[model samples]
Each structure stands twice: as C-alpha cells, then as structure tokens.
Target: MSDASPVHFIAHFTVTDGDGYHNYEKRFFPVLKPYGAKFITFDDNVTVLEGEREAGRTVIIQFPSEKVLMEWWNSPEYRELAAIRHQATTTFSVSVIHAIPQR
Candidate 1:
C-alpha cells in the first residue's frame, strides 16, 4: 500500500482497569493532533450483528494517510500512553484498514 492511502485504526478491547484506561484516553487526543487524525467514534456497547466475534469497547480513528498514521503509531508519546492501555484492557485487538482507491 502506498503512503498516500488513507487508513482507519479500529480497536476492540475490554477494560479491566478503568482508571488506567481513562488515563490513556485523557492523554490520547493531544498526541493525535499533530498527525491529522480524526476521531470517528467510540462505543462501549457494541452489538455483534453477525459472526461469533466478542465485542467490547470499540474505537475507530481515521488518519489522513498511512504515513501519518505510522508516524503517530510509532511516536514515543503514543507508546507511553499505549502501555497504560495494555495494562488496562483485555481481549485487545487492533486493525489498520486501508481505504479503497477512488474509481
């Protein structure tokens, strides 16, 4: 995939330590700003319409491009905050999906 392609960061997790996760959330937006990340949505009550996938807290974020997203993902600030999230959540899963090219 090209760096110009837009991407979405989708995450699902169950918060085991609310306080730690909350701390991560509070600090997330500021670090995300420089990368042109757009907050799509977050849902604590996700209903699985199909499949047997277990749904927990769901977060969706859109980045202008994969290049920008990777910069943010690999940044030190985000890494520090992510450590907190790792300790707080269980069944954690994250997926980076690229948007299809314009027809």
Candidate 2:
C-alpha cells in the first residue's frame, strides 16, 4: 500500500460566480492546510465519458489518509470554502471516497 495512490472522489456545483477560478484554487490548498488535501484536480476535463456522468464538475483531492480526508471534509476550513462555492454555484454535492490501493 505504500506506493498506492490516495484519492477522494468529489463533485462540485457552481452557480458560476465571475472571475478566474484560479484565485480560489490557489488559496484552497493553503486553507486546507490543517486537514491536508495534497492535490486537487478538475478531473472531468481531462477524461472523456461515453454517457452522462455527474452533472456537475468532478474534482479529486488526494489526502494524506482516509481518516484525514474525513476530518478535512468536516473541518470548518473546508466549510468556509464550501460557502463560497455555494454562492458561486446553484448547488453542490461532496462525496468522500477512498481508492483501493493499487497492488
């Protein structure tokens, strides 16, 4: 499991607030400092789907561990960003999932 990847499945809904999304993305990692999400990606853009996937944008946050992932998900820091996201989008759905270690 040492070499295995850690990824969290996430989907976000944006009300489409103006300005560069980069602004938020830059600060997000730092804000998630305490809980620690190592990497965040807007995934669907890179991969193609044959049919309908989740309606909203798909993001993956690689955490230090599964426990940390849960902690971060509930952390107030994340909650703060969530508020901004909500305002930016009509709605959002966040799901926390652990990837099976690649053997």
Candidate 3:
C-alpha cells in the first residue's frame, strides 16, 4: 500500500436553522464524491474528556490529500451550497488536519 497519509476536513458548528441546514446536508455527499472525499464521522453526541468543550455538531471527512480537499472546498458547486450552511449555522469552524503516519 502507498504510504501517503489522508487529510481530514473537520467541521464544528451549531445549527441556527434546522431546515436550512438540512438543505445543505442534502447536497453535501454528492458534491464530495467528485473529489474523492469520504465521511469518517458525523456526530452530535460529543463528549469532552479534557479541555473546554464546544457545543455543536462535529463532522470529519477524509480526502486523499490536501490538494483534493482544497479542490472540493473551492469548487463552484460547493461554494453555492456552502451559502446554505452559512445561513443555517452559527459559530461554524472548519479545519484541515493531516494524519500522521504510523511507523
């Protein structure tokens, strides 16, 4: 197998408008497919074991590389759908993380 590590796109957000957020969710998976993105986890049942916990939903998506991740994020189709997410959520935060390879 190739040693390339996958990159994760992590999002933490609180929904302000459920219907609007649901609209965004409907389009999420289809848009991701073209970029080879896969959902690692999407959870609302989060527990904090250490530092301060933020109240919201957490989503983790994985891509083969940063380039692929950016391509998905910067796509015109995604940008259009992202507006729905912006309108539906409050305190949205997204981060890209590179997985560390095991020795």
Best candidate per TM-score, number? Answer: 1
Candidate 2 residue-wise lDDT, 1-103, digit = tens = 5423465757665537654344556567787777656666775344545764444566667777666776776788878776766666654577766666566
Off by over 4 Å in 1: none
Better of 1 and 2 by lDDT: 1
Local error of candidate 3 at residue 50 (angstroms): 1.8
lDDT of 3 by residue, 47-100 (tens): 888887577899999999888888888999999999888899975678988876
Cα-lDDT of candidate 2: 0.63
Clash count, candidate 3: 0
lDDT of 1: 0.87
Compose the digit string of candidate 1's lDDT tens values, residues 40-93.
Answer: 999987777877766578899999998899899999999888888889887567
Using all chains and alpha carbons, the TM-scores for the candidates as numbered come to: 0.89, 0.63, 0.88
Candidate 2 residue spans exceeding 4 A from truth: 1-7, 20-23, 53-56, 90-93, 101-103
Clashes (backbone N, CA, C under 3 Å), per candidate, total 0, 4, 0
Clashes of 2: 4
- Number of the top candidate by lDDT? 1
